[model samples]
Target: MVLDFGFLKTEMMGEIDACCDHGMMIWVDDPWIASFLPFTSREASAEVMQQYRAEVRETGQKLIEGPFGKTLLLSQVPTAENLAKHWFRRLAPRVRLRSGNRADLLSVVVWETPNCMATYHAPDLGRSRPGLSPRHSHSEKFPNEIGGIAGEGGNLGSHERSTFSQRF
Candidate 1:
């Protein structure tokens, strides 16, 4: 799988807006133009804050300012300079092609979609191991499955156990 970023920028800023609407962590890379309140002035007076907000709306920029002076983050999609900077003349991957005596090699590909990232890895090259294979083996107790909250009816507290038992 391969993801092409070229098509994303042409949309109606929908991709960026969707990311923002979901409250996802957005970190603008270098060269993206954004205005950040200085550390000493992050907690501006109410009047100043209102002015800043007005300016942001007028310029179509986003502001990330918290109550504290130290926590201020500003991010905006870069257009002219940054876009030019991001351009790459050529993108080439080094791949080894089997010509003569070389054995077949496996390949892995990754694609980034709007909802999630997809990763595909070719099966092993006929090598067997004693332990489980990472590609096909998965534990129910993965990192994201904290407190036993994994599959349905998993890790329910004792209070709910009776209700779950009745349904089963």
Candidate 2:
């Protein structure tokens, strides 16, 4: 599938108190932005990364100075799922605008860790399910592998296994 990758800086905190306060260096790499423009994937990823870094730096500063302290201020809770949807909403329109409506954004997967992730599929593309396929079956492509490795004999726990199954 057409793919692009980027990063976003965010933080999470309590609704009223600063308990469980922490920052998130979110990574959005799998099934990313696709452009029909002349730029290569490397160039596109670099540009997107640069733009997002600038936004994160500026907005993060504002949020830090605001009443919320260092949290990534949002209307909804800054969970991984919400962050994925947030990035999808922010990027999809730009993709359509830049590609002249030639690109189809299948989904945006936000990785909270190496294994844990949250995916946001394009509803307009008939992606009603969370991790199903509208293009091709991932199982057919990699019949006996998880993350391109033969068998599941790594440090993969149940959560990682489930995530890999849904992703690859």
Candidate 3:
């Protein structure tokens, strides 16, 4: 998985103490591309692949130069959960469009640390299903800790360390 980390600047440190108290960072993963590497070379065009890579790199650059540098201030809380959802929303449509709806973005997980992370699922894309696999089953084990937000489940377990996940 190609994990992209974005450093965001936020002023709301007093409310919820983020893992990165000094500087907040969000991790985004492209698991679909990693999973289908063999098939991607044959099925996907070189231009499409280059464009995807460029876009991902450009996004990280913008976030670093803009938000991380305090040149562009975000209105949101900039928490792990919120950032995960925000990135998921931003990238999902683009992924669908670029891949011609062939790619399935299961979830976007913003990591505050190796142990703590927040995941956002795409409900409309038919990717957010309950009790689908072992990963989903973990939420059931810690329902009280793993709070449900807008049909997307959150895992607060320390053992369940994952930056992002896909169905495959």
lDDT of 2 by residue, 1-168 (tens): 222221111111122124224532222222322231123578775795566456655543113322233333343456778765665665555544443443434455556676676666666443332332434312334342111111122464422211122232
Query: Which residue runs of candidate 1 sit more than 4 Å off their true CA positions?
Result: 1-5, 9-43, 67-168
Residues 56-166 of candidate 1: C-alpha lDDT, one tens digit per residue: 445433445433222222233333222112111000011111112111112221113334322222234225212213332222333221010011123544222111000
Report the lDDT tens digits of candidate 3 across residue range 51-134: 545654565311222223312112344677876665556555554454343333445555567578777766653234332332
What lDDT does the true structure give each of the candidates? 0.26, 0.39, 0.39
Write down the worst ten-residue block by lDDT for model 2.
4-13
Error of 1 at 24 (Å): 8.5
Error of 1 at 88 (Å): 27
C-alpha RMSD for every candidate? 19.8, 17.4, 17.1
Q: Residue pairs in steric clash, candidate 1?
A: none
What's the lDDT for residue 38 in model 2? 29
Worst 10 residues of 3 by lDDT: 3-12
Q: Pick the candidate with the highest TM-score.
A: 2
